[model samples]
Target: MKAAKPLPPYLVRRYQGWKATTYSENSTWYKHLANEGQHPRAMVISCCDSRVHVTSIFGADTGEFFIHRNIANLVPGYEPDGAQHGTSAAVEYAVTALKVAHLIVLGHSSCGGVAGCMAMCSGHAPELLEKSSFVGRWMDILKPGYEKVKDEPDPETRQRMLEKEAVLTSLNNLMDFPFVREAVEAQSLSLHGLWTEIGAGALEYYDPAKGGFYPV
Candidate 1:
C-alpha cells in the first residue's frame, strides 16, 4: 500500500494568513477578552457533530456564547453528582458567572447519535442497554421521544421525526433544574429549541404559536 500524501504546503500557508487576519481584525476584542474574561450573553447546548458548529453558523464573535457539546446535545435532568458534569457545569457557569440571558438547546437533522437512539428503540440486546457507559446512558435521556414515535409506519422516517421531537423533549427537561426554572420565572432567562438540516442548509425555530418548528 502507498503512504498517504501530506497536506499541501499552500493550505498550511493559507491558514497562517487567515490567522494573521483574525488577530488583526479581532485585536481589540481579543485583548479585552483576555483581560476581562468571557461574559457570554447566552449558553448553547449543541451536538458534537463537526458540521453543526453553533458559532460559525450564528456568526458569533469571541466570548459571546458559552457552549457545551455532547452526543445529541443532551441535558440529563440536572443530576446532583459528586464528580463533574461537563454539560451542567458549563450551564451553571453560564448562568451564575456570565449571567446568561438565554439557554438554547440546538439539535440538527442527520444526527448519527439520534439514529443510534432510534436503533436502541428497535429492540437492541439487554447488555447493550446495560453497558453503563456514557453514550449508552446518554441516549436513555431521549428514550421517551424514541418510544413515542417507534410505532410509526416506517422506521427511517420515524427516526427523523423523533430527532426533532427529541429536541423539544430535552428543552422541557432543562426546566428540571431549579436554577434554570427560577431564571425563566424571573424573566431573567429564556429557553429555546432549534433544529437545523445539514443537507439543505436550512434552519428552523420552534414556534410557540403553532406549537411546532418552522423554517427561519
Candidate 2:
C-alpha cells in the first residue's frame, strides 16, 4: 500500500472550521434528514473534478440538489439490472426515491477526461486503447459532436468543440431514461445542460436559439 501524504495545513484548518460550523449550525436539520430521508428538488450530474462543485456553483444547500459525479459527467441510457451502477443508481434514487423536479447535466472546460478522450482520438495512448475501453466508449458518445467540428482548422479548437459536443450528448442521454422521459413528458420535470470553463470562471449556457453554447 502507498503511504498517505500529509494534508496541507490550510486544508486541515479549513476542514476544522467547516466541521465546527456545520455541526453547530446545521446539526438539527441534518439529524432530521438522517432520520426521515432526503428531499431534493433537482439532480445535478457533474464531473468528478475538484474544481467543479455542483452545489457551490449553484449556491445550493443540503437537500436541495442530488448530485452525481463521474469521469466526464456522461449519462448512459438507462438499463435495469441487479448490477451496481454508480451513475444510474444515483439517477434512480433521485427520480424514484427523491422525485427531483429537474435534472441538469453539468459539463466543464479543461476536463482531464475529455482531454483523455481527445488524446485517444490521435492514436496516442495505445495501451489505453487495448486495456481501457472507457475512453473509447465515451468518445463514441461524442461521435456526432466530433463529426460536427471535425473540419475545424486548429486541433485545439477541435478538442474544445468536442468537449462541448460531449456535454450536449450527455444531456441527450439523460432524456433517454424512462423515468426522466415520463416526468418530462408529464411536465413535472425539466432538463438542462450547463458548460463551465475552469480557467476563465465563465459559464456558458446552452442556447437552443444559437444551436451552440454561449457565455452566460
Candidate 3:
C-alpha cells in the first residue's frame, strides 16, 4: 500500500489560520465540548453541495447541531435487510442517541443530484442509468420526487419544483423510521423541510397546511 501523503501546503496553512483564530478564541468552549458531550438541539440533514453551508445559514456553532449531509439530501424509506445504510444510521443515532428535538431535511436550488435524477428519469443521462454509477443509484431515492414535476413546461421552474419536492419527499420518508415516527407521534420530536437558493441566499420552508414552500 502507498504511504499516506501530508496535507497540501495551502490546506495546512488554512488549518493553521483557523487554529490561530477560531480555535484560539473558542478554546474554552472546545475544551468544554471535549469534556462534556454534544447535546445538539436539532439534526439537520442537508445536501452535500459545497455552496450550501448549513451552519453558516443558521449561525450555528460547533456542537450545536448534529448534521448529516448526502447527495440530494435524501432519506430513503425504512429498509431492514441488513445492507449498509449510512444516512439511516445517522438518523437513528440522532433520533435515539442524541434525542434531538427537531429533525430538518434541507434541500437546495441548482442541485446536481436533482438534475441527474431528472436526466436519468427523462432518458437524457445514459451514464447515470448504468448500474455502476453510485450517484445514479443514490439518486434513485428522488425518482418519486421527479414524477411530481416531470411534465412542467419550463425547465428552470421544473427544477425548482423538483428541488422542493426533494425536501418534501425526505420529510415523508423520514417518518418511515419507526423511531422517528414514535418520537414525532409522542411530540418529542418535530420534522421540518427547507429549501434554499444558492445564488440569492434566499430560504423557503415547507408549510404542510398550504402544501408549498414559502419564503422565510
**Which candidate ranks first by TM-score, i.e. highest?**
3
User: Which structure is stronger by lDDT: 2 or 3?
Assistant: 3
For residue 102, model 1's alpha carbon misses the true position, in angstroms, by 0.9
Q: Write the per-residue lDDT of candidate 3 for residues 1-216, one digit (tens) a residue.
A: 478898999999999999999999999999999999999999999999999999999999999999999999999889988999999999999999999999999999999999999999999999999999999999998898888799899999999899889898899999999999999999999999999999999999999999888999
Who wins the lDDT comparison? Answer: 3
**Residue 103 of candidate 3: its Cα lDDT?**
98
Candidate 2 residue 35 Cα shift, in angstroms, is 3.0
Clashing pairs in 1: none
Give the per-residue Cα lDDT of candidate 1 at 193: 88
Taking all chains together, each candidate's TM-score versus the true structure is 0.87, 0.85, 0.98
Model 2's TM-score against the true structure: 0.85
The number of clashing residue pairs in each candidate reads 0, 0, 0
Ranking by TM-score: 3, 1, 2
lDDT of 2 by residue, 60-83 (tens): 877788889888788776667776
Judge candidate 3 against the unseen true structure and give its global Cα lDDT, from 0 to 1.
Answer: 0.94
Please report, in order, the local distance difference test score of every candidate based on alpha carbons. 0.84, 0.79, 0.94
Question: Residue-wise lDDT of candidate 1 within 1-216, one digit each (tens)?
Answer: 488886799998988897799878888988999998888888899999999989988999879888999999888777886877887777887877788999998899888888888777676644447777567688898888887788899866887788787788878878887888888999999999899988887888898789988888
